[model samples]
Target: MQGSGGPRKTLPELLSELDTMLGLAPVKQRVRAMVAEMDIDRKRRAAGMKTAERSRHLVFTGNPGTAKTTVARLLAQIYRELGVVSSGHVVEAQRSDLVAEFLGQTAPKTRAVCESAIGGILFIDEAYTLTEGDYAAEAVAELLTQMENRRDDLVVIVAGYPKEMDEFMEANPGLRSRFANRVEFPDYSNEELAGIFRIMARGQGYELAEDLETALPQRITRIPRGRGFANGRSARQLLEATITRQSGRLATMGDIAPEALNLLVANDLPAPEDSGVQQGDGGARRSLAELMAELDGMIGLAPVKDQVRTLVAETRVDARRRSAGLKVAARSRHLVFTGNPGTAKTTVARLIAQLFRELGVLSSGHLVETSRPDLIGEYIGTTAPKTRAVIEKAIGGVLFIDEAYTLVGDSPSDYGPEAVAELLVQMENRRDDLLVIAAGYPADMDRFLDANSGLRSRFGATVTFPDYSDEELAGIFEIMARSQNYLLSHDLRQALPAAIAGIDRTVGFANGRSARQLLERTIARQAVRLAAPDVDLDALPDEELQTLHVGDLPVA
Candidate 1:
């Protein structure tokens, strides 16, 4: 294969480069198969046998930063080596590159792009965005015409997310016919990601310390695997951040060794809280490890936490299966969260939304909290729209219906059942992007599911949060007090277990809330003692004012 200038590369040499790419086994296999087909066609033509012309157009589907553009560029050169096209360069484009804002300019704009790549490859990034508007549709039509007229000289490759590319292909019959060849690029594994990081660091004259070489992969594993996770690009970003952090650390020291200038240690990696997963919608960046740490820090939800970890594992495996081009059965993402009040049900639901967003299962990951009132209506024929509005608001995230049982009332004429019916339909239609969580007390949740048989099938998993133990309740009190900048005296801490044990765990007891209420009362008592006439306000140190003694403990 001849280049613009320099030593010519052979067909085998071009293929060797493709094989050397890290962590794209499936993509490499598919490209090799395409090459084999091209070789057979060439031999058939040489033997004077007739062969039908095949479409050279290709579709690349996957999340960003999986090397789709990089592969396309190389594939163009391979096409040139096979005598499929005159040149092997690729013209990269997006919706803005092909579509014109004015009504009359779209065709000319689209044609200009295609003409520029007449002897090369036209690579459209996020090609699905063409179906988004009226002007964009005109560009698509022009593109199709050019693809057909220039089929002998030009190859067009469209790339985007898997689900959206499916829609994009369906948008035009011409697209389905022309782009018959498809290849999926999966996110890199943890090991591949670490290797990418090291490669980038070496290019910039930096080396990872021995401890950091081992710790890098572990750190990558903690990052949430999301649709926006730029597999290779993220590795580059992490390397840049690590370098920045190392520079800051070395600045603090009076003297730095020459060898230390280009070395990065484990401590140079960004903290878990700072290295966040960027959401699909470009919302706030939240770290998966930080969210998991928050969930783990909560008191006494061992079983519930385990269930969440299982969900994370499932999502990760499902992603791998899809990337490998395996047929994955469509599974329900909706869940049933059951427990009494103050068992961290709502808190857990919120965290799960953020977690799913980080895992690429959700787009926005924002939680929309609702109940019966938010769904049901006061007048007839109004319930469906109201319920739908709430579901629409939570399309790319989780819809948490607290006290979900309230949606099914005793009255046959009630609108609650109407809301439930609407919910059932919308949940099915939007299950691809939406996750619905029904939460309430254990018994009430059972009643709610039993009321509607459809609910049970949709909510395959149920995580029951048990009431907190007396010891756990004492821990909760301390956590709450400390959060408010108040300290418990040593004796007060010792008395907390006995005090918590005396509280009755009756219906509607609000297990965690009870601890909070006790803390509030103790703080009030401390305030009264501090204001007494015998106490010297000015002489009292700040520490004494912040501390709560045995006298401040609420009576059992």
Candidate 2:
């Protein structure tokens, strides 16, 4: 053999470089494998074999903040070392950079970028944005031709949302075969995201408070449910937001109190603003504590109550373990509350926040509740930022999304799917400080999970809230009656069982929620009866307002 130089630089070297810079090991290993094959091809050419150069095109599909860009950069270095191209630079572009206004401008503009990235990698971020019009279509065609003409000299990586990536491939048949290597960057699991945040936090020289550290993962798991606006990008945004909030709080305090500076206290994270509540003008703003206290006093839901208590205990144990310098094991904090409308999912979510606080998982244990409409935006690019804003507010607390399945729809223009993808990403990234609980009809929820594998993987534990039994409905009715200070007469109590039993058998009845509605209707009927002129108002004491009889109830 000709003078053997020191053993060839292996693929692991490229992976090690990526791991050092970007903290992405899995992606690095993948790119390393690809690079190793390229190196093999290089040696074959050197030995005078007639093997053709293998194409280095890659397809990157994943939610944002999964470190696709970072890995892309490292791959460029590997390619340069393998002598695939002269310059080892990675040129990053998106639809905005390629598409042009004039009729003939698109091709030249696209080619210019390709030419500039010669002998290196050209990364197209959100490459699906090229699907806007015929001009963009032509631009993509030109891009493919460029790739073919310079196959050995260049590498192109196209990336975007998964569905869009599918569409992009379908739109260009030549591209499908050209991109031989496809790498899907899956959304980081809750535990993975927690680890990422911990790394970032530690690297930044911040000592996460013991209680806050313990509570972060549960908070992260609950973030994606109803909020349409968040995903992995939201997690990064949340971290940045926390940093900003912490900086602001620090600024306000003139003298740096040593204790305050040492501890990442409750005030370091900002409180979430309620979207449902109007601001500026005088309006009712209820505290979560008040809501939890009121809900605790309501009767029934023993199973739900017990489960909530257990969750609280687990959180406390985790917190204590963290405080004691013990490693906490990853467990799913996901919950599925399945009662019919008004069976206390919202109320329970509020209580869950307080439970988080008591267990040292949250600072204030506030609840930020949203629905599908809160997340899905009217346009394409707006969804990501809007969803991120909602998560930012819900940080350090519970982000409850009710009727979450509504975010998954059939239409490309629906924007619901976009919201879902974003939510998945954010859930992965913020798996420490945000808790997301999504509630909806059981069937719809299952379908939603099925639609996105990333979601199925992220929401590991789903607690189903079964419909209330007749007895439980009766208890709910009693709770509603007591709330209005109304006492059921002996006759009404006797009739109540029969009425509740009849309701339980009804086709469309929504468990205990329907029972509460019936009780409210009874209260309204009593009001209407009292308004009648025939009633002897003068003879009846004010306590009569608190009394309800069989006459107040309606026949089923």
lDDT (Cα atoms) of all candidates against the true structure: 0.84, 0.70
Instruction: Give the number of the best model, judged by TM-score.
Output: 2
lDDT of 1 by residue, 445-544 (tens): 8999998879898987999999999999999999999999899899998888888998888865898998898899999999999999999988999999
Q: RMSD, each candidate, Å?
A: 12.9, 10.6
Per residue, candidate 2 scores C-alpha lDDT tens digits across 146-166 of 999888777899997665776
Best by lDDT: 1
Model 2 clash count equals: 18
Q: What is the lDDT of residue 431 in candidate 1?
A: 67
TM-score of 1: 0.58
What's the residue-level lDDT of 313 in candidate 2? Answer: 68
> What is the alpha-carbon lDDT for the whole of candidate 2?
0.70
